[model samples]
Structure formats: C-alpha cells, structure tokens
Target: MLGKGIIKGMAETARNFLGSYVSAERLTTVQYPEQRIPQIEKARQFPFLVFDGDDPMKGLRCVACQICEKECPPKCIYIVKSKDKRVDYKGQMQLYPATFDIDLSVCMSCQICVEVCPFESIKMDTAYELSTTDRFGGLMVNKHQLAKSNEHYRHIHPTDAAASDAALAVEVAKAQAKAKADIEAKAKAAAEAKAKAAVITPVAPKPVAAT
Candidate 1:
C-alpha cells in the first residue's frame, strides 16, 4: 500500500509535467514586466506629499506642526522656520516656516508622516521609480523638489486625493463656523455688560417717609 501511494504521487507529478507543456490547454505562469500586473488598492509604496493645485506653495497643507518630524523613526525631515513677514487680518505680522526639507536617502517610507498629519498636508506617493547615480546629494529632495500639484496628486491617487480634499474642506468650514460663533458670543456679552452698567438706580429722598 505504501509503494502504491508513492506510485500514485509520481503519476500525478508526471501528469502535471505533461500538462505544463500542453500549450493552449495548459494553465501556466504569466509573463512578467512585458505583461503588466495589477496592483491591489491597499498596496503600500514609496512616499510623497500631495499638494493643492490652485496655490502651489500655500497648498502645502503642512502648518509646520513638526509632529511628523518628531515622530519620524528616521530623522529624515529637516525644517527651518522664518518670519512669515505677511500681515494678518488683524494687521499683525505672523511667523511661519521659510524652509522645509526631507532627505529621501534616510527616509524609510513608513507612511507615519502621512498618517499623523492633522492637516492632511502629506500623503505617500505610489511612485517607486527613484534611481540615481549619486546617493548622497541626488537622493535628498528639498521642498522645491518634493512639491507636487494637487492635480498631480489626483493623477496618481485619485480616490485618496478626493477623500483628503473633502476632509480638509469640512475641517475648514468647522473652524470658520466656530470662529464666527466665538466672535458673536463675545460681542453679545460685551453689549449685555454695557447695558447692565448703564442702568441708573433711583435715589430715595430721606424726607419722603416724613412727608
């Protein structure tokens, strides 16, 4: 019976060997590279940031919170902040970042930067075609090099880009509404305080009771 089992297994192997060469009738391996393979939706690849198309620089959604920098397993991101020099709505000068850099050589592409960004400023790119002659200088990408338009982002990851845009819009609307409500509440409280202060109390004459 043991010998019969071995013979049966060998017979199956022989059949498969013959089946592989059956050309049109065979279920066989696919040719790679020349014949492309479809990628799954959730596949993780090289990381890059998504930008808003309208205003390229301002669209950097990153508020320079530095949470990504601190959380990075590798210290790949380098950021330098300078005075914004732009006048705010209150006519006051604001301080903002002047320079932001990321060294791709050190980057592990862990997607942590993309994950932790509260502003949805950054996301992992699907592009895996990075090859260069020089490893040290050529690999490290600066802000200018790293920047990509929102249109470009949509082209690469349309579904994710759309979702991020929607989320950002909602956040902005909520912030604006909350700010407006706060301003109105403050104004109402001030008016009520003023009205209460303006109330005049009648002075009772001491001789009124005697009269």
Candidate 2:
C-alpha cells in the first residue's frame, strides 16, 4: 500500500494525457497568453461591490456598515461611513460609504467578504486578467472601481443573483405595504378625533335664536 497511491495517481495522469488527443473536451490545459478557456459560470476570483442602477454611487447596496471590512481576513477592505444618508432603490434611506477601498495585493481571494455581506452589496467576480505594471496603484481599488452593476453579477452568477433579486423584491413590497398601512392608520385616527370633537362640542345654536 506504500506505493499504491502513487501508482494510481500516475495512472490517472497517464489516462488523461492520452485522452486529450482524442477528445477536445478532455483537453483541460490551455496555453496561456494565446489560448484561453471559456469562463465558467461559478468561477470566482476576487471580491466586488454590487450596485443596482446605472449610477454606481447612488445604486450602491452597501450602507457603509463595515461588517465586511471588520470580518475580512487580510483587512484588505477599508470603508468610511458618510455623514448623510440617501434613499436607496428599495425606498429606504441608507448611509453611503464616503471612502471604500480594497487592496487587491493583500487580498487572498477567500471570498469571505462576499459570504458575510448581509446587504447583498458584495459579491465575487470572475475577472482574472489583472496584470499591471503599476502594481501598488493599480491593485488598490476604490469603491468606484470595485462597484459593478447587478447585471454583471447576474451574468456571472445567475442563480444566486436571481435569488437575491427575489428577496429584494419581497422586502420592497413589504416596506411599501407597511408604509401604506401606517398612513391609513394615521388618517383613520385623525378622522375619529375630529368626529369625537364634533360630538363633544354639541350643537349650541338650536335654542339661541328665540329664547
């Protein structure tokens, strides 16, 4: 059994090597700089922020919560909470990040940021062609650079993005419904208060004319 594992591994490698000649699908190795494999759907390489609408800043899903920055293993992510808040796509006001940056050089591509993000603001991207001469400056990505549209997320991870969209839709509906209910309750209360005042005051004018 000492050499059995090694032999099995060699056999598998040999089989794959021989199989590549006959089957195009079996050719797993791609010659870099020239030949490239089609990007797989679930292929994740780095973390990115997801935004909903066309404007990255306004549509940013992150509320500057800093949960991901705190949870990040390498501390590559940095966020600065804004002083002011703006209404989000879901009709909820949220604090946008004044400064959001990520040092890709330090990031290990662990995807922990994606896992811990509750706001669906962060997700993994499949882009791997990140070569740059200016390593330091180029690798330091800001919020504007890190922000990607929801459409890109959907294109990369259709299933998860679809689920996220569905959840957001449900939340938006619930918020709208709750707002409507609150308005109705306030209006009903005002009407009832007016009626009570009218009843309490009583008509004093009936006996005043000829008494």
Candidate 3:
C-alpha cells in the first residue's frame, strides 16, 4: 500500500497524456491571437471617453469638470476646459474640454477615474494590446483618440452602458420639466400683471380735472 498512491498518480497522468489526442475535453492548449479564450465581461485594461453620437468632439459627455483628472491615482489624465460655451445633448449650456490627454505609459489602469466621473463620460476599455515603438508620444492618447461612441461602450459593457443611459434619460427629463414649469410660471405672472393694469380706471385724469 506504500507505493499504491504513486502508482495511481502516474496512471492518471498517463491517461491524460493519451486522451489529449483523442478526447475533446482533455485538450487544454490554446492557440492565442487566432484562437484566443473569450474575455470576461468585467475585464478592463485602459480608460476611454464615451461620446453620445457620431461626432466624437461635439457629442462627448464630459463637461471638462476635471474630477477624473484630479482623482486619477497615477496622474495620467490631463484636461483643459474650453472657453467657448456650447449646448450639450441634454440642452444645457456646458463647457467641453479643449484638450484632454492620457498617457498610457504612465497609466496604472485603475478604475478610480471612471468611478469619480460625475458625467458618466469615462469608462474602462477592454483593449490590452498597446505595444508601441515610438518613445515620445506613441502611447500618449488625446481627446480625439480617446473618444469612442456610446455604441462601443454598450458593445463592451452592455449592462453598465444600459444603466448609465437610463440614468441620463431621467436627468434630461427632469431638466426639461423644470424648464417648462419656469416658462409657464413667467407667462402666468405676465398675464396677471396685464389684467391688473386693465382693471385700474382713469382715476388720475379725474384728479387732474378737479385741480
């Protein structure tokens, strides 16, 4: 019984070796690139900006709030708010980033930027193949390059993208409703003022005639 355990282990190993050629379940080797293992849904490697529509620059969800830039652990993100104002997709006047950059060489791929972002404009990208030959700026990504469509975000992270989209829709609806209420209140106030003016008689002319 002393050598029984060793015999069993050796027999198992031999069986596996022989079964690898004939049994589909026994084959474990993978040919990468051409036949890669499926990536997990939660797997993330880098950060990318999410845009709403076809134009990346005009449709970017970021208002250049600089929260992500300040919260970045590695200090890889850089941004500058635009001086010119523009109306966003939500019909609110907002400042876009004139310049945004992320140095991939220095990035730690921490999801803190994505978490601290208030606008839901930042997301972790699944791309990991970022090899480069240039030393100065090949890995330095700018706003134009970092911007990706919301459709792309849904493709990579369907659940998260759906939740964010729903939240944004709710916010937009709230803002629109507030704007409509304000307009109605102003119109009602103006109508009341006009009615009070019309109700007032020509008492001033009667007083002048008595003088």
Candidate 4:
C-alpha cells in the first residue's frame, strides 16, 4: 500500500512530463519577451500614481496631504509639498507634490498607500518588470516615472476604475450644487437690498431745508 502511493505519484509525474511535449498548455516554460500571460485585474506588483488628463503633473489628483506617505508600512513613499498651489480636479486650490519618490527596492507592494489616499491618486500597478542594474537609482522612482494616465488605470482595472469614476462624479455634482446654491443665495440677498433701497422715500430733504 505504501509503495502503491509512490507508484501513483511517479505515474502522474510521468504523464505530465510526457504530456508537456504534446500539449501547449502543459509546457512548463513560455517564450520570454515574445510571449506572455495576460495580467489579472487585481494583480498588483508596485504602487503608481494616477493622473486624470493629458498633463501628468497638472492632472495629478494627489494634493500631497502625506496620508499615504505617513501610512506606508515600509515607509518607502516620500513626498514634499509644492511651494505654490494649483487647482485640482474638483477646482479647489490644493498643494501638489514638488518631490515624490518611491524606493521600490524597499516597497512591499502592500497597497496601503492606495487605501489611505483620499484623492485616488495612487494605485497598485500590475507591472513586475522592475529589474535594474543600477540598484539605487533605478529602484528609486520619481513622480514623473510613476505617473500614469487614468485611461491606463481603466485599462488595467476596469471595474475599480468605473466605481471610482462614479463616486467622483457624485462628489463633483454635490459640490457644484452647493456652489450654485451659495451664488443664488448671495444674488437674491443683493437684489432684495436694492429693491428695499429703491422703495424707501427720501423724507430727509424737507428736514434739511428746515435746518
């Protein structure tokens, strides 16, 4: 009975060994550089910054609040607030990161940065081809290198991207409605004041003449 189990294992191994030659699926190795497996949507390798529009720097959603950098488990993320402020996607003036760097060598790809980020600026990238000869320089990725378009995020993670977009749309709509209400309230108050002034009678002219 003991030897029967060993025999069964050997038989299975032999089957796989021989089947590899006849079946493409059974092949242990794939042709590198020319052929590759499709990347899974949830497969994450490293963290990358996501930008909305064509301009990577201008369209970046990160306000450099340092939430992600502070929360990073490995403490790989480093960020510096910009000296000048710029408008964000929500049209609110915000501080961008003048210096954003990630030491990929120390990065554990825990995705903690993505979770802590309020702006949805950072997300996990599926790319695993980070081999480098110049260990320090190559591994230390800057903001320019980490920045990717929102379209790319959609391409890689369609489901998450859709949800994120829907949430953002709702937020924007609420903000716009609030702004409109505030403007209308101000205008209405001004109009009411002007009408009240026009209706008031000028009785001071007779009194001044008596004086």
Candidate 1 structure quality by residue, lDDT tens digits, 1-211: 5599899999999998887878555754567657756665555565555555465565555556677888889988877766555432222344334677888778888989888887676777666667788988888877677777778767777788889878877876776787789889899888888776555323433456556
- TM-score, prediction 4: 0.84
Q: Is candidate 1 or candidate 2 better by lDDT?
A: 2
Q: How well is each residue in 1-211 modelled by candidate 4, as lDDT tens digits? A: 5699899999999999889889988776779899898877899999889999899988888899999989998899999999999988777789999999999899998999998887788998898999999987999999999999999999989999998889889878888888889899889989888777666646334345556
Q: Rank the candidates by TM-score, best first.
A: 4, 3, 2, 1
lDDT (CA) per prediction: 0.70, 0.89, 0.90, 0.89
Model 4 regions lying over 4 Å from their true place? 21-24, 192-211
RMSD of 3: 3.7
Clashing pairs in 1: 48-125
Among all windows of 10 consecutive residues in model 2, the one with the lowest summed lDDT is 201-210
Q: List the residue pairs that clash in candidate 2.
A: none
Where's the lowest-lDDT run of ten residues in candidate 4?
201-210
Candidate 2 lDDT, tens digit per residue, 1-211? 6999999999999998888887999866688889877887878888888998788888999999999999999999999999999998678788999999999899888988888887888999999997778988998999999999999999989998999899788888988999899899999999899888778767645556566
Better of 2 and 3 by TM-score: 3
How much is 54 displaced in model 2, in angstroms?
A: 1.9
Query: Residue 61 of candidate 3: its Cα lDDT?
Result: 94
Among all candidates shown, the one with the greatest TM-score? 4
Instruction: Judge candidate 3 at residue 32 and give its lDDT.
Output: 73
The pairs that clash in candidate 3 are none
Stretches of candidate 3 off by over 4 Å are 1-29, 199-211
